[model samples]
Target: MYKKETRGMDIHTFATDGNQEGVLAELEKGIFVDSRNEKGYTPLACAAKSPHASVDLLRLLIDAGANIHAKVGESQRQPLALAACSGSLEKVQVLLDAGADINAESPSGYTALLHIMFRLHDNEMLLPMAEFLVQHGAVMDCESQYRESPLSAAYLRRRWDVVRFLLDAGADPSPLRWSKLLEAVALGSCHDVKELLRVPGALQQRDRFSRTPWLLAAFVGHLDKARLIHAAGIDVNEIGQCGETALMTSASIGNPEMIKWLIGVKVDLELADEFGQTALTQAVQFGHADCVEILLAAGADPSITNEYGDKPITLTTSEEVVRVLVEAGEDIGDVSTEMRRILIGLEGSSTLRVSKSEYQEGCQRRFGSSNPETMDVPFWQEMIRTGIPAYESKSQFGDLYEMTCVWCFNRFGASFTALPDGRYVQIGGEHEDYYDPDFCIYNDVVVFQGDGNFTIYGYPQEVFPPTDFHSATLVGSDIYIIGGLGYHGSRRFGTTPVYRLNCHTWHMEPVTSTGACPGWIYKHKATLSEAGNITIRGGTIAIAQDGVEDHVENNEVFQLDLTCMTWTRFAAEP
Candidate 1:
């Protein structure tokens, strides 16, 4: 060992063990470190192998002027790249600070960040190494032999913070030829993803799959985030790679809230996807009753058949949905043979224009076209009068006031003949304006009576108006009012109290637990399955902490079995 040491450090042990300090010292002392080890690794190879060798050691040998870019025996890894791959951020920093090439190419043509990003799992060290390399003029767009850039690697690993840092340090996220912003949003769902979407030039870019952020969010059921993206004006209905619209994607995922919100914004529910299935078909096929209802209400065509020749009604399991479709089919009266002949005649005629002489005569006779754009006040009043009946039929005020009280009475599934005051009498399901009970009659009406003074059979019942949206659900024979806003005098009440209604007797039960029964949630949707399980979906909990108000979609589906008197989470199969 001593004799070989005198001949400088031999390759035999240095190649196997990578103990380069002794060999490095001997090289600084004018002794040549041999490359003929058992595996033919030189001192440089050994130094690169450990990668934790101090900068002083590297510098001492480099001053003796060892090649800074020397490749290892077989792997051909340079010392700087090896240091990066080993995740020795300190050693990497030292070597780069000592004028080691930041842009040096390895045998595989990987930059330092490329090696670090691909090999090291530590983001803390990798981030600094990445920053240091980019700060010292490292090429951010350098594509690996695998056609991956540093930005792509960061995106694949879902390191949005690292991606942000890289982008800030002049990394071109464009050569990725994909929306790293969408990938970040899809994977991380980070709030900082908003920054990437707002990155000025990012919205116009599409991914390799040709999907925008809005399409990706919709596909992934990130409804709230998708809404934010849509409000940013990136074309909510833009068809993606397979001509799949956001509406189709939302429907496929059974996201009723997203469907309703999209419909509320007037998204074309009739638009078909690549598979030629409309949003309504997708919703029905997936058995999303709520989504089906919303789509139907939004005027989705029930008659349009898919490639399978099945309409939306064929996919429903509920009798109520079948009845709705049957009623709708009836409303579309048949076309007459004479009407068809008249339509065909109009279509085939081309010289049907009224002459200018006829128009002048008609205008003079009608006392119109004087200013061309203006009409007589009485004439305009007639037009307004014509619209009043239609407006009243559809308006909320008309529905509440002028519409026959029978319609309102039927809304609560109540049976009554007539009152002495010439008003329709209701059997039950009535509440005052200030305090209303959450009650539904049969399959017809779900009524929420608000708090106010109400005379029930000429007797006043003390009222409590439901404070929040999720205060009630009528499941089977029971009206389950979970949590709501309570008012005591002028003070506001916020509590989660589970109430049950057996026929007409109202019983209150206090839910004394945490997590399962959270306090005072509004805007919740509750469903009662045929198995008698009550499933509550999303809602907003009314509470603030640390000066911050919090709202949640309440992804947990809870089931309260009346027989067990226990609340168990409903774990549905995805």
Candidate 2:
């Protein structure tokens, strides 16, 4: 349904317009041999745009003596340059291997690689072809018609890896072109790009924009790169176009490491930006606490207010930060009494002293150090003898102590053995705290079996009387035992027997005479609140008839009020 052009435009035009096979057949017929289109495009130039331009077609065209140097349209771009620009690497290699000029200048006088890099900005293709052309003795220093070489093109595109490879391959990054260096620094190609300015005469040579390498690197926050240039004996604190030093740029970026390095290298920290803000002031305004700490530790004045009259402490929302500034002798006039109290509390407890042998052992254990010099043995003994004291003077919740086996020292589950001395022993999870007979101190609550055969003897007398499997809670000066299955012999005395123990004597109070109370259960969590209320959570509930078979869940919450001496059912939705 398409009309052919009536004019003398030959089959070369047909090849460019999707009649590749028809044109090749006509060319083989030798009728339109060496025919030219109106635009002077050869059959090869037309076939370059065809999707079906196979290797056989290309070879046939070349054998028919087709002009490989042909250009399409007014652009006058060579087929090789067109292939490179189009990213057709196969077509490019085909044309190049077929005696197409590798370094043939385009209509714009740009070599294929330079044109590709400039137009497509593809480093993947540009780098390989550029290297290939250059390795094949394509001119490295040859300037394009636009006065830009491949090096300048790579630099402009910020392809640092390609730029580095190109430069090492003897591509001259002309120092006179200041845009190349500026572009390199702007694009973070500072690592090797700055080396271009380090060439013997390039440092002294100014760019076209009249900016030096030091100025450009500083402007772009390439401090490490700038430091490299500085190590070459250039001024570390060199002022740029706006009188901005490298230190000021680092301060603006809040890079503490770079600032520390600059200060160590003797770059003046006192140097201010155009707004008269020093590095110390910048750190405070940005609320970089570690940087502020570093600056203050290096003798930066925290008292110096910024333009808004806000000191370093005022900029921080952290209490520890304010305390740190105040401890550094920063004058914070007449702070709140509560703030003063909090700050005083922040002074922390005194360092605990330990013997040298224990300290070395502690250090060795903590740091995993085999070296004796790094170990502190005395610290370990003190840590073991007296664990850190409890924060409160009195444990309000009534103390809970864990007891383990002396040999195995394992934690006790529901199954554990009671020794003849009335001491409970567990297997596995043995620790030092388990062996301490004085584990439960004054007012500490201890749970024991309700069987009347066992007695816990402290120093002078029995601490807790003989009891069976029953739950107890410790209040101010008394131990209250609640309902449980009382033990006589091997028989279960299922009764709700309540007992109260004072410092003088233990007395039993019968709460309820209900027959066959719930069976004895252990390993239950007992909690005592501040309002004289007791809660027993999560334990087995069982009713003993003749044999202990119907043991249901005691997952329900139970509460006892010591003031009223009455039990209340907690209405928690199950």
Which candidate should be chosen as best, given lDDT against the real structure? 1
lDDT of 1: 0.53
Which regions of candidate 1 are displaced past 4 Å?
Answer: 1-41, 49-52, 63-65, 73-75, 178-206, 209-574
Residues 123-163, model 1: lDDT tens digits: 56777777777777888888878778888787555465677
| Candidate 2 stretches greater than 4 Å from native | 1-20, 28-40, 49-52, 175-574
Task: For candidate 2, give the lDDT.
Answer: 0.52
Candidate 2 lDDT tens digits, 1-574 = 1223344365766666656577667766664444556665656776765555654566667777777886555667677776666556677778878888877886677777777677667447677767666776677776776687777676555466677777788777663365544555545465666666556754443444344666556544566666666666776766653456766655555677877877787877676655556666666555566676777777767666555655555555445555467568553322322233233232223343544343333332121111111222344223222323321101211222312111110111211222233322111111223235322111112222323111221221132222333455556555556543222232233333455644223222334423223335433445567788766665665456575445556656666666766555554621
Candidate 1 accuracy as TM-score: 0.33
